[model samples]
Target: MDVWDLNLRHLLAVARIVEFGTVSAAATAVNLSQPAVTQALSRLEGQIGMPLFDRRHDGMVPTVAALLLAPRIDAAMARMSSPYVTMSRLRALLALADVGSYAGASHVTGLSVPSIHRAVADLGTAMRRKLVERRGRAVALTEAGVQVVNAFRLAKVELETGLSEVAALNGQETRSIAVGAMPLSRARILPRAVTHFIRRYPMVKLGIAEGARPELVEPLRHGALDMMIGALRDPLLEEDLVQIPLFDDVPAVIARAGHPLAGTAPDRRELARYGWVVPPRGTPLRESFERHFAEVGIEMPKVPIESGSVMTLREILIDSDFLTLLSPDQVSVELEAGWLIQLGALPPELGRTIGLTCRASWRPTEVQRAFIEELAEASAGLPGALHPDLSPLLG
Candidate 1:
């Protein structure tokens, strides 16, 4: 069954039944008659395509599915008890979590201190758990609160997507996409795709957040990012994420223009003589670099700086003779502008399959899916876009 068919009341009834272990007790908790609570539980089971509870002589026995879905439903129900739970209440919780204080939330939301306090308290009461803890002068979200906050953020995005979809159906123009851009994408693929996307959907807003894999992965999982573009992991790291291949990104040894190593293929020992700039430790790029060096019978060169910032590395490369390893597409602009030169090419095994990364369960709206199509079209035109060997390797 789909999420849209899910009724909050039915979910709550199921949860309460599991909690109190009887329809009569659950009915009292939600202030409904036992028959009504039983009907709600039935509806919930029908919607989910499974029975959440077994009616035993003693009470209701929760299934494994009920156990798994209970916490999330409980968290959602905590802030959604009354029909009067308004957008303001949701905003208050988000703001409080963001700014870390009721006063700060009040300042950001332009709501009164009392209103913020009431909203936050009501949310906590609804969840039957304390969302925030105050240690005299400090405030922090409890673990349960953090889960609710993430779910609320996901709900907000879903609401926006619903509005955008309805607007599109009615011929109104409004859309937005949040993209997590990695190093390789910032250079060529992502920029080109964004340029094309805007031209195609001018009314659509594009938000880009740049970072390494570790920094971006959590956001994607939490639904804060629509999609991420960059080098795909070899083993496809997270079970909850899906990676779509677009093109092959091969690495190169790069140096400043007119550097002594610019036009020559230096031996491994000669390559080891110079100080280098490399990606931070524990990244795919760093691991690949190390593996490549090990295969060539040379130790990793001395690194003056470890960085993933293209601009920062470019500035350093332009003034010093330091060699840096990078995806060719990442330095396309500098190479074309004569600010950087490709000293040598890396082996094919050093290649990474660059593409899109998103939560495995993500269901993109029409316009959002259109942008993915645009990204694919953009990648098709890049040099060495096809890598037949990559399929087997990634597989």
Candidate 2:
């Protein structure tokens, strides 16, 4: 039995059963009779080749498979229940979101103004909330409308991914992965893993977007990115995001090979004497760098240039004595090629946890999970790969 054979209502019944823990209660939730719910559960179990629940005198207990499947089912059903409930309505909403007016949506979607207007109105009515407001000749979504549009957008991605997963099972490839690459990830981890992933899954398309954490977080959250691989936040800053620790990003103070600071561990004041190329303010690296100095009661060095680019920092350091803090992994090639010198590692307390970050609600497809496995393999021997002291924190 194929999951494709299960309708939305059937999946909803499964989720409801899991949530309510009894056939009668689940039937109440999904507006089906108890007998109908029981039958649907039976059919769903048969189709999936697994018993989602174990019947006992007290209640039905969900299996591990049911627990894992519940999130995807709930997410997809949420999309189906969004204000733009059908494809036509969703398309109209999306068009309006893009163009900001019913007439513009009509022009873009090749839908009549009345059709677009009715779709938007119906969406608002379905959601029991006003989505758009007219201001002069333009239409603008209210806060609630923006949220609904974002949900619809995610739903579109989810649907496409579902199709791609189905195609993969049939020995067909119709998938793409978008990765948000932070500085350390772009330098080694992501590139290496992507090369390996492509060699193995040649049919799957891949996109790599490089940016700072602040730049990538929104896209990662919005479903524009499959996942982000880079420095993990200490205490895991974003509640809506989940971080999987891969390693520790222990930064090093670096300078040119022949610089006066080479082979010498300078004190904080002496270190502050040199001009620096540091990460932009508010970054984890920058915060760590500042904390190191603050702990020693010394002001941060004069920033001759601020950048997140490893290459830029390396070139600057190579040409002059501009000290900067970076993960040694980020400048491994340059350091090996005799272009840069690592002055010293940051104090043991000053490292960032490097890892994978994704939306907390995200459910990886088989291919995406495979890619993550590839990433883990590629990052195996990376420097500072999750020190023992930090293992407990990660665990």
* Predicted structure with the largest lDDT when compared to the true one: 2
Model 2 lDDT at residue 56: 98
Give the residue spans of candidate 1 off by over 4 A.
1-88, 383-395
lDDT of 1 by residue, 1-395 (tens): 23434555566677788788988988888778888888888776665456678889999998766765665556554434444345667788888988998899989888998998898888788768788888787678999889778777666555455445544544565567889999888887787888888888888889999998888988887778999988788787578788888888678888999998766889777888899898877777787778777887887789879998888889999999998889767778898999999878778878778888887656676678778877877788877675222222122
In candidate 2, the residue pairs with backbone N, CA or C atoms under 3 Å apart (3 or more residues apart, or in different chains) clash, namely none
lDDT of 1 at 155: 61
TM-score of each: 0.74, 0.76
- Consecutive 10-residue window with the lowest summed lDDT within model 2: 386-395
User: Which candidate leads the pack in TM-score?
Assistant: 2
The 0-to-1 C-alpha lDDT of every candidate, in the order given, reads 0.76, 0.79
In candidate 1, how many Å is residue 290 off? Answer: 0.7
